[model samples]
Target: MSVAATLSPAADVRADFPGMVTGDGAPWHYLDTAATAQKPQAVIDAMTRALGVDYATVHRGVYGRSAQMTLGYEAARRRVAEFIGAKGEDEVIFVRGATEAINLVAASWGMAQIGEGDRIVLSMLEHHSNIVPWQMVAERTGAQIDVCPLTEDGRIDLGALEAMMTPRTRLVALAHVSNVLGSVLDARAAADIAHSVGAKLLLDGCQAAPRMALDMAALGCDFYALSGHKLYGPTGIGVLWAREEILGAMPPWQGGGAMIDRVTFEKTTYAPPPQRFEAGTPIITEAIALHAAIDYVAALGPDRLLAHEAGLARQLRDELRALNSVTLFGPEESAGIVSFAIEGVHPHDLGTILDEENVAIRAGHHCAQPLMDHLGVPATARASFGLYSDENDIAALLRGIERTQRIFG
Candidate 1:
């Protein structure tokens, strides 16, 4: 069935968010949500309450309030794990963001497993966070990095990816959705491919976590990383979900506090699965805020949220396609993002004009310079959607574009 037909009706859930309303009485059109989403009042309230009502450190302090705060922090991990359909709470470990999550795996897991004569396969659609870590690993271990190509439609070239897979392939890393093109890669299929070549897969799920349904077992990837802020939560909190066995095998990425079982003058043993990964003090309040964000998204339901965003995407894409100066990128059926370029107009200039109208959009390489090179463009304008996005927001974007053309032409 077509994704459009499969979509369910979204409830008028935008009312829960106060940021949808503009302070100056002019409606603000938020379009750079792919970079960082606006937080709902529920998330804001949760963070504020955690800090205001009872603020204390988690996992270490022996005081009563600290114990209560630790419970809250651990509860947030369970919440995030269940939200992503992870098998158990132990699978989820908190990090700074998706960037840190990838780095953790690369530094700890990748460093231990990858060696000379090994190959790490990545895709053209990967963010710099996904790409650079592997490159660093390869430089240190003498492993070769192979890139899977993108089809003309901007999806991963499955044929090229299959060909790139070899016996020496150590790890396969790819984005679940392209930050630049909004292309959704088939994680399950990619996992199958990686397994066929004896390689484990890691999905950079920052772009997909907010918009797509995730089941770690179904995806069959070794690891999946997500950012809290992009998922409508607070910053400084993210998740790295790995298979239980994989987590057991991976060495701790960082050291200091909370991750140790025994600290002696000569030797120390690390803690178990999650706490072992979570070194030092965590963002306890932010983790609570993330739980609130997950509740916010869960209450709305993924199917309904997806449908609303899909409708908005179709409308925006169709309208933009009608413009003479515009050139669209990626597949016809994309996620809640529309990337485009205007003839003789720079993306920075376009973004500046949109800002004048209080319409925010991302204008750059989207941090995937390789993908930009593949698409034969230095940079492009990208408008990403969220639950608060509406049809009026798209219309506002069109109006801003019209104004830009009038001034530039």
Candidate 2:
């Protein structure tokens, strides 16, 4: 593995974010990228311009500004589709976030396909968004939910996953990246296994989309879900990528205007792939902002951003491991997140102390309570990096931990 170090590297990335400048305040060291990344000026500017000067309803308006807004909105869908390497632009359905995307798939596709005696496979490492939706579908369809166990090192155990894949399996929903452990799953291999059993696969790509290069077609999954906020994009905008055939057959998840091609008091016919999933007035400004965010990330190049984050993670992990009281989890080569539990200190209290120091980190189950239970802790403090994260951020986190130890030790 090749790792390169460039001088004044993080400074350049930080310059693009207005939030990086904390006025008359201590340097804010943000290490909670996994929760939601700080937005760049490009994304903010795009959204401001759209809302400030060119705001209009998309896909329904006929005026000049409306046409421009509609074009920008559709263009964002294309960028999101291309970013994740979807087969067709229409495969990408915009939703509020990954949670809503999963709900849509489980409610629409799962409701239509899953039935009595069917099984939905999931990993114990899944976020609640991935796990709960399947459980809901299983309940509605009289289907069973099976959990794929994880290896001790935090990665998904393929052998166990294969064992759980019975002929009755209807769908397999899992995370492309474990939120808590920072363990990257071999989604392609998992997708292949699911397909071999004649089951469809859905990946919660919220964590993987920003940090990793995702090719949905190559991944062989039937559906892929990701959130824009986690990728430095606007909130209330997410991507749900499904094979056109599958999306076309699934029932509409929500019922409202814009999704139906024709409607009568007695009957209704739905629109195409994306519009079928999008039922109401969508988050137009946010979608446009997300496109700008995608453009910003593309400009920086995912390869370079990934390498920089990995470098930061490696350095943090090495240093944190040297702390006698800290117990770290996950693979040695992991995502740009380092999760740890300090003996005699609760994660919440640690987070509070860190916040006082202006060093933000996530402290909780991280919506991966199953993984937390697997690790035998109620919660862990997670410091996840992003494009603008630097060595100083990592150092601030360590200093915050030390301060926590002094207070609580």
Candidate 1: tens digits of C-alpha lDDT, residues 1-409: 4343345332255666777657876767889889999988899999999998879988778999999999999999999989998999999999999999999999999999999999999988789999999999999999999999899989988888889988999999999988888888888899999999899999999988998778998998999999999999999988999999999998988888889999998999999989998888888999999999999988878767766676677878899989989999998777788899999899999999999989999999999899889888899999998888876678889999999999999
Clashing pairs in 1: none
lDDT of candidate model 1 versus the reference: 0.89
* Candidate 2 clash pair list: none
Estimate every model's Cα lDDT from 0 to 1: 0.89, 0.87
Error of 1 at 277 (Å): 1.1
Q: In terms of TM-score, which candidate is strongest?
A: 2
> What local lDDT score does residue 183 receive in model 2, on the 0 to 100 scale?
82
